[model samples]
Target: MADKEQFFSNVYDVVAAYESGFVGAYGNPEAAEALRDQIKSAGGIPDGAMACSTYKLEETGKGKLSLPFLEILKLYPDCLPGGAQGRGDCVSWSSRNAALGTMCCEITSGIPDPNSGRLEGAPEVTTTARLNGVLSTEAIYNWRRHGGDGWSCAEAAQVLLNDSGLWLRKKYDEIDVDFTQYSARNAGLYGSRTPPESWRKIGENHRVQTVTEVEEFEALRDLLANGYCVSSCGSEGFSAERDANGVSKRKGGWAHALAYLAVDDRDEIKKLYSEPLVLIQNSWGAWNDGSRRIFGTNIDIPVGAFWARWSDIKNRYMVAISGVNGWPPKKLKSYGARGFI
Candidate 1:
């Protein structure tokens, strides 16, 4: 309890300083001063704090504010950082839970097949032959002229809620899922364009395949249990469900892919796919959307993003692998420890 309380207090101090005007200069001297005050109030020493042990001091030996802030971050990993690096751009389901996170929406806009060998650009490749333009056009058009209703991350959350029956409003398990309510409520408060009532139906005709929207948690869980990860690159290559040791399983979708670790006591997920936790592999390295900003902007999943029953998992990631050359040796013990994918 003391640990949790201390963590919250530290977060409050950091947030208060940022909101007060310490971060006002947009990374200028004034912002640094506000940060210093914030750190002092939060019971941190300023001069002694360093950005990182490895960061070389500036040529003139000037003390950098970002460094101290980074040190504070290292000390209290969960506290909101000094600036908006972890903040989100749009008010969506994520904002209601904790600090508004930095946007990591990789432009699935125009990515192409990796094997296509088309070097026009990364974004161009992703958006190609994908629903990027269609989805964007529909969303933008609906938001602009038609009731300001279009697709957004919030809408996606709503769809998840609606299908999961969480929108029906009984007793909620996923507190973060409740932020779906903000999609419209905050939309009104912030006076931003509202998302569309419905989204373009994902279909084979649209070059997108979708399962029937389901609501049963148990059934959803079942689907996820059987899903095999597919590459986002849209190539014939598919990722292994169970790793070599057969503990973690790979979960992939159109935008990103990661390995699934064990579930928590509450049945919450713990991903092992990415780094720092589990790395969520984005086609766009660190620069593009959906990527982490470890240096500047990045996506770091602490508690794992969302939980889906095996049914939903299967619907999201189902593939059939036929030919394979080499396979890993049998390791049943590892399977039990990690839950083979």
Candidate 2:
């Protein structure tokens, strides 16, 4: 059996490969609504969404490697495979979001005084830094080229905050920290700056649900505030011992994100994720360590417990999800100092 570290490392490499196109990940550049319409025209929800293959479904009921999963591909017909203007399909975001979420959960399972799993070179901005203003603007520029609403960084922050249950009830730029802009900035910056916009709103009023304790659901709640889907221990909590079958279980709110798709209530929620929901996209690869599902949990950060780096989260065990198909590109693998990819 592989060591826990090796297992996660392998998972990251595969996820990264899929995202970087090493494994033929595809998508369309059309708007999400458009793609949704196309799927509806084709045959409604695809039966293969649960298969875990990064391919598209054709009318013939066959699977082929193509851009955009069935759900979001149909809408973005113009979205080509590998280009500056390429837009990610919904599956792309789902996979990436789930993998990252899972990694976070694995490492932050328990609050270590000095957290592990932080990115090495991320800037250590103060909690109240105004860095989000720049990040929100940058995200708008990046996402806009791919066919998103021409939202400003500030606007994005507000949306993120509102989504996370922060109650950001103000117009763009009018609110100290916009949820839309802040949510994007949080993931992109990885907590470097909570966006002064958020700081101002949270100033002296650091009160949000499920954050003070740093439990699984609590951390997930924070992730939800930022606009990412979350899956976790399902209130089952964490356990240090492997189960009777030698499988480790994620009991409580371990901070992590794995890839997963949301489903309708009428369907038989398979319950693959954690306790609260079904399905979890793991960065730890195929071998299940008994973790939670990857959908319908909170992943937004509460206003107060937002940590700037993995270290800020005050836990050990850095979990990484890669968008590459082969070995992940990390500092240790860099042989030369060219400083260029």
Candidate 3:
């Protein structure tokens, strides 16, 4: 409890300096533990699950998958995922919107740049268009957020799995309700209280099936290298806006939830930063667009997104991989594919 207070105090101090009015509430250590117990009981993540650590791409059949970077933005180019607009509904935005959308894109479109000479994803579901757009941030946030102040990534995962199920923009018709497209006002307005019951049930088809707790680097990379996406919430803040490399400077404060949509593990990037970079998508709408190509790669640093080093985030960042409904999709060949590494 003492640590949690100190954590929020630091957040107030750090973000207070910036004019972006960025509010950070990633839930403290105490909140995480309580949520973890609840998550396990709800069957979100198993008692002893080791998914990515045990995942292996068939050595002989799939061939060498050379990934200079795992770019999710390349898969789904809605760089600005609507925006949090100072709301604490980041868990909803990151979990359902960025993470789930990108994973669905991968499953439908295959790797952005498959240098492995094969398209690997569920091509059978290519006709499914609803999974391609931005989900309703308020639908989940309205139900799971703790009074619009904060919510953990795990809690958001639970919301996606069982509680409220998935709900996309009314345009996508992810649910029965005519939940209009997302906006800063609607997210803030409806999310201030519980949502109507009619907006709860996930579309009969689109639902997150499995949630895996991933605390290790190898595990994160393994899942990302495939077609899955990971969401995270941690107690940390950036000192300044993103630099030329698109890397946000760590300020050592803030409880914030965000998503890791891509990974930049290029040798050149690692050599310069001393570790790989994780492409983070923030809920803040176009909050920071200052970026440059660290190397000769077409990795688009979206408006609301930035990059962070693995060394800096490995310890404090808590993440969970959300596997979509269509698991183990077909591996289409990327013979003439355009993979953005």
Q: What tens digits encode model 1's per-residue C-alpha lDDT throughout 269-323?
A: 2233222111222111121122122222243322222222333333322111101
lDDT of each: 0.21, 0.24, 0.54
**TM-score of every model versus the real structure:** 0.20, 0.21, 0.69
- Relative to the true structure, candidate 1 reaches a TM of 0.20
Between candidates 1 and 2, the lDDT winner: 2
Per-residue CA lDDT of candidate 3, range 202-243, in tens? 433445656666676666665565656677777666644777
Model 1 off-target regions past 4 Å?
A: 1-145, 149-206, 228-341
Highest lDDT against the true fold, candidate: 3
Off by over 4 Å in 3: 1-24, 28-49, 57-76, 84-86, 109-133, 145-148, 171-178, 188-197, 202-204, 326-341
lDDT of 1: 0.21
Best candidate, TM-score: 3
**Model 2 over residues 1-341: C-alpha lDDT tens digits?**
00111111243453343333331112122332343343346443211221112222112211111111112112222111111111112222222333223222322233221223233221122222222211122222222222221112112222222222222112245443442323423223212233344433432221111111122322322233222233211112223333322223443332232222221121112233122322232322232333232123333211111111111222321111211111112355554678644
